[model samples]
Every structure is written in C-alpha cells, then in structure tokens.
Target: MDAATSGTEDKTPHRFHRSLSGLGVIILTLSVLSPGVSIFVSGASILQQAGTGSVIAFLIGAVVCYCQTALIAELGAAYPTAGYDYAAIGHAMGDWAGATTYIATLINMPVFLNLSAIGIAIYLAPFGIPLSATMITFITIATVTALAMLNIRANEMLTGIFMLIEFAALLLVAAIGVWHAQPDAAVCVLNPVHLDNGVWIAASIGIIGIAVNNSSWALAGASQALMFSEDMKRPETIGRIILIAFLLTVFFEIAPVFGTIVGAHDLKAVLANDAPFETFLGQYLPAFLLKLVSLSIAIAIFNACLAGFVGLGRTVFSMGRTELFTAPINHALTRLTRRTDAPWVALLLLGTSTALATYIPLTAKLLLLSGSTTILTIFYVLGVYIGRRSGRTGARYRTPLFPLIPLLGVGIVIGEAVVLWLDAETGRKSLFICAGAYLLAFCYYRFVLMRRPGGWKMRGPDDIDALVARDVVDA
Candidate 1:
C-alpha cells in the first residue's frame, strides 16, 4: 500500500528524495545544456550566417531566455514539483494545455538527445576516425541509457564530473585565446561577417533569423532544474539555480567562441573550421591532448544525453501520476522502484526510443524540427497571467518585472517559432510536425479528459506541493 513505490491504484503520489542540493540541481541542469558542446554545434551556423554578429545573436538569445526563466522561477518556488513547466502551464490553462505540453516533451526531449549524441561523428571525422556516425550514435545511446538507469544521486555525480571536464576545457581555451589575441581582433569581434570587407550587403541581414535560432538553443532547458525540484534538498534555491546556470552557460558558450576567432585573427578560418577546440589545442598544446579534447566533446554530449534521459523519466512519471496520459502508459511510467526510487520504466522508454532513433538517417534539419516542437511548449508562459489572476499567489519567489517578463517571453518565443518556420534550412516542414503534435494532444484531451468531472481545471503549483506533502506523510 506504499503509494510512493508503485503505479497501481495509488491515491498518493510517488515522491522524490529531498537529498539533492542546489549545486546538484545546477550541475544537472547545466549538464543537460552542455554549453561547451552546444556552442560548437550551434556556432557552426553563426559562422555561416552572422559571423561576428554571432556574439550579438548569442546575447540576444540569452536576454529573451532570461525573461522566460524569470516566470519559471516564480512558478517553481510556488510549486517545487518535478512537473515544472508541465505543472505551471497545466494549472493555468487546464488539461488541454498540459496534455499538449507533455506530448511535445515526449517527442522533443529524446529527439534532442538522439541527435546530439549522433552529432559526435562530426568531431570524429576530423580525426580521420573510422567509426561511422551510425555506429557512434548507437554506442553513445547505449552507454548513456545504462548510466541513466542508475540512482539519481549517482547520475548527478556522473554529470558533475563530465560537466567539470567540459567547463575546464572551455576556460582553458578562452584564457589562451584571449592571451594570443590577433591585432585588430578585438575590433573585428564586434563587427559582423558581412562587414569583414568593410562593406555590407543589406540582403545578407535576413540571416539574422538563422543566427537567432543558433543562440536561443544554447540557453534552453529553462524548466529542467525545476523538474528535479522534488528531489532537491533545498527547494527554496531551485528558482535561483536557473539564473545562475544561465550566466555560466553564456560565459562558457559565447566567450570561448569569440575568443577562438579573435585569437587567430582569422574569421574565415574559424568559420570554416569544424573542430575549433581541437585545432586550437593542436597548435598551442600537444597532439595527444588534442585527441583528448576531441574525446571530451563526445563525452560532454553523452553526459548531456544522459541528463535528458533522467529529466524525461521524471517528466513522464509526473504526467502519469496526475493521470494526464492514458492509463496503461501512465501505469508503466509511474512504476517507481526502491532500487533508487527511480522511474525505471519511463527511463527505459526514453532509452529505447533514443537507441532506435540512432539507426535512422536523421538529418540535423530533421532533428532541429523535432526539437523545435518543444518550442511550442514554451507558450505555456502565457498561463502565468491566468494563474496569478486566479489566486495562485504567494510564490516563494516572484519573477521580477512580472507581466512584462512573461508577456515578452511569450512574444519572443512565438517570433522565434515563426522564424524557424520560415527558415529554408529547417523551418516550414518542422512546423507541420509541431502542429501535428499539438493537434493530437488537443484531440485526446477533448475526448478523454473533458467529460470527466473536475477535469476542466488542472492543479496549480500549491495544489501539486500539497500532494507531495501528503505523499511524504503516507510513505
């Protein structure tokens, strides 16, 4: 009859251990992002599109994301549940939005993990390594799956270790690049690639859409830390973890990028180079160390994929517990075990999907489309006004600039989604997939949930917190 231990007819919810610290939350959230790895992957477009304006694009992305995180902080402090954005939005809009958000997550999270893992092949190719992208993808997905199924604390430790390796590598690169700055490099860093010839093509400016897309992806995972709020030791600091992570993510992702180009006094070389860190290390450091740095790139992504696994497991479990999904799948997802009290079934579901995805001939464009579906979920911010108006007040931390933050966040996200839709590289078709997911969820909610009594209004943050408290007592 232990409600926290199983999926069977348990009136009480499964609970997360409060043994996690704020630092653990930050480490896990930042690992999910993998800034060092992400900047390299995302920076490829910046070199192609905005070039020197890459700095500006990254900063703009950060500011827009900051607004979104502000709203999340307020909601997270009030609710402090693993559901995070799912809960925040659900409370404001009702079952329809909740179900749609959940569906978007189930699609986007694993797709992101799978694509990022397979991307290891890009670095592997530069070394003349023999492994195909498919093989690398399979190996990485398998390894991370096994690792993700471990105890949450152990996973955190593993992520912490990998995160440190990447961050240290980034700092080393930044310091050395800054030290070896090429003449006029400082001035050029502030200019766009189009202006490199001291001339500008007004038409080329259109690609700011592409630059904006690259920068925004780096600062995502806004709701990830709060997804672990249930397991965190100090719930009060959950709100702060995101803001702290944002600052560091920018420093690591943006600074090193500009440093590498400026240090060499060669924008074209840096832009054309696929393996900037490896190239830099080879010239300034040892060859073996270059190989090690390449290995670290793979490891950083693998670690990040594992973080996605853990977050996906928690999210599915939370949705299932609240009966937001079908009973059978929810039954499977909520089957928690004392082994680590982890949601093994949900983790397995994600692992299997990611492993399967690794084999398919998925392009970066396709993956971007799949991942952008989650951008649809960020619209949940619109619910902030709805929640506040309905007396869901007294959050532990209210977002500064209140309505402006939430309103601007919703607007920026919508604009980005529009840009992505218009993107010749990946936008128009991805819009179909994103739209389809939303359509499916809305249909399901209308059919299955609407007729149910008291299903119209979803639980707000306080309501979710109360359930967790009760589950603790029941356990």
Candidate 2:
C-alpha cells in the first residue's frame, strides 16, 4: 500500500528542495523586520512613559526570547518535524498538553494575520490609499490566497524579495541616523532615572512585556525552519541557521532603538506621533527620499502580512497532518498537486481566517495575548525539564549548563506569568479568553475527534527517529 493508505506508515512526505545557505538569515531578517516595525511604532509610546530604562527592558526581554529560542532549537534538531511546537510539546509532555498548545497556536494564527492586515492598512493611509477596514480585509485575503496557491519555492522567493526591500529600507534609516548623529547624545539609552521604587518596578515590568511582545515574534518561528530541515543539505545545519538568525535579529532589533533614543530627546513626542521612523526620516532626510521610504515601509506591511500567512498555513498544515484536529483536514492538506506539492485547502483556510481576523477590534492586543498564550502553553521550561530527565543519551544538540539553563527558562516563564497576573491590564480577560478557547477545543476533541478509528499516534524517541527516517526516505 502507498504510505498514504497504510495506517502503519506516515503519510506526510518530505518534498522540500534546498535553496540558499542563508535561508535562516533571510527568514530571521524578515521575521525581525516585520515585527520590529510595529514594535518601534507602538513601543515608542511605552518607552516614552518608561524613560531611558526602556532599553534595559528590551535587553531583558531579548534575553528571555533567546532562551526560549535555544530550547526550541534543540527540540527542532532532534525531531525535525513540521508540527513544530505542537510536536515538541506533545513529545515532551502528553497528548493533552500538546492538544492545548495546538489550540493556542491555532488562535494565534488569526490574531497575527489580522494585526498584519491592520498594520498594512495603517501604513498605507499616509500614501492617500484610502484603504478602509473592509478594503484592508479584502486585500489581505485576496493577496494571501493568491500567494498560498503558489509553490513552496515560489513562496520562498517572494519572501526573499520582500526581505531585501525591508532590509534596504532599514539600512537607509540607519544610514540617515548615523549621518545625522549628534555628538553630545548619550552612547546608549539605558540612562538611570530617579523614581519611586514601586513606580519604577511597575513601569519596568510593563516595558519588558512590550519588548517581549515585539522581540518574541522573531523567535516565534524558530521551529518553523525545522519544518524545512529535510530540504537542508545537512539537517544539523538548522541549528547554526537558527543561532545566526537570532543573533542578527538581536543586532537589528537593538540598533534602531539606540538611534531613536539618541535622536529624539522628547520620547513622549516620538511615541505620540504615528510612524516615528518616517517622521524622523522626513525631518533629517531629503523630502523626496522620505516619501520613497514611507512607501517602502507601507509595502513592508504587506510583506509582513504575507509572511505571517505563510507561517500560519504551514503551522496549521502540520497540526492537521498530525491528527491534532481532524483526519479530513489532514487528507485535504496532503492533497497537494504532484507538480508543486502545495496544499490548496490549507492555503485557503489560512487566507480565510486571516481575512476574518482583520475585522476584529483590538487586534494588537489580541496579537500580544496570542503570543503570550502560546509561550505559556508550549512551556519551553517543560521541554527542557523533560530532556534533562530523559538523560543525554540520544541528544543531537545538548544545551550547555543543562539543568540550570532549562530551569532558568521555566523560572522566567513562571515569573512573567506572575507579573502579568499582577498587572491587571495584561491579565484577567486575555487569560480567560485563551482558557475558554482551549476548553472548547478539548471538549470537541474528547467528545468527537478522539473517537476516530485512525489517527497519528504521539511518538517516543525511537518512534520519532523512525518517523524522521521514513520522511528522509520518502524525500
């Protein structure tokens, strides 16, 4: 029997093709740039309120994201599954935990897609596009649909082109800032300010949350790259790719913050204004070039939208294939055209959900909440704990300082959850929403889906190795 028809055999085939060595660099760059734009734009306001200490906040958050990335990287190298967090959590924890995390991921897809769509619409408004909410939704849906229909290689090429545009735009801004640098400005923005202890702590926590929200987007897709591991000439190379991408992202994420803090003395003014970077460009650069830059940034919003859609599609496709949802969804996802091997059903679902999310109010809040939910549910801490408990016998990439690093990850996540709980603005309602969604999914799974005769079984170490080997053979 064909693998697809044989219940004992894995049906998901690895048909990925190798591309650029710098694929991780490109993906990371795009991931960082896309979210970095929104963060700089929105985060300026928070930085203003928090003062120069915002830099410290960002540094702390970046470190946390790196820790999370490190844990996932190890997991990804070992499993090399498209299922990513769903697979990792399932393998490390249990089916229930994996199912819960999967549901959070599902919710996150729409939240991010909607936020990207809104961001694109807002960015374009300055160009006299007059894009309404409805138009934005339509454009987002249509564009994503068309792109999703393309082959995987085509998608990568399109993403690479968009990343180039984004990189150039960011480079231009950095150049302008450097040329306009004031000698008297501070070397860094983390200057200490006198404030009451309670107020200072509260402000710092809030700012850290914002930074985490921004930087986490880049780190979010680290596992997604593993989905393409079969295509890599050396699957182990994904580890290096992830490390390089994240380090580069660190530099890119921090550089502009330093420039913005130095250039704009009035953080409040910078924050309150829409498109602070564009405004900075207008004041410091030539008028015509400023317009061009603004257009580029607007186009960047679309780039982010498209990239988000692609990631979301792959994530859902992976989950469906693993039988976390329904067998029909998996069947649909695996029904790729022989020529391109792109699943149209998964793509259509991604586009439809993204378009729908655009209409939701408080999209930015939804996005942040969604990210937090995923991080919490997936529990990088739990993964590390499990790995250490399993002993280092079969580890492909063992994290240095084993127990400590993993323990630290768990502590940080727990600490962040506690802080969020205390900060009412960020807590209560969002947690409730996430909880309610998971509970509903669990009910459905327990009552209906689990009764299915055939589904993918959650695998142990030997089983996972077998699965990976099978995929390699199929490829």
Which stretches of candidate 1 lie above 4 Å from their native place? 1-9, 124-131, 194-204, 280-283, 360-378, 452-464, 467-475
lDDT of each: 0.69, 0.58
TM-score of each: 0.88, 0.83
Residue pairs clashing, model 1: 20-233
lDDT per residue (tens digit) for residues 343-429 in model 2? 566778877777776656783455346435445534666765774465411256655567677776776666656655655664645
For residues 276-337, what per-residue lDDT tens digits would candidate 1 score against the true structure? 45565555777777777776777787778888778777876787777776667766777776
Question: Highest TM-score among the candidates is held by which one?
Answer: 1
Model 2 / residue 169 / CA error / Å: 2.2
RMSD to truth, every model: 4.1, 4.8
The per-residue C-alpha lDDT of model 1 at residue 329 equals 74
Q: What's the residue-level lDDT of 159 in candidate 1? A: 95
**Model 2 weakest 10-residue run by lDDT:** 192-201
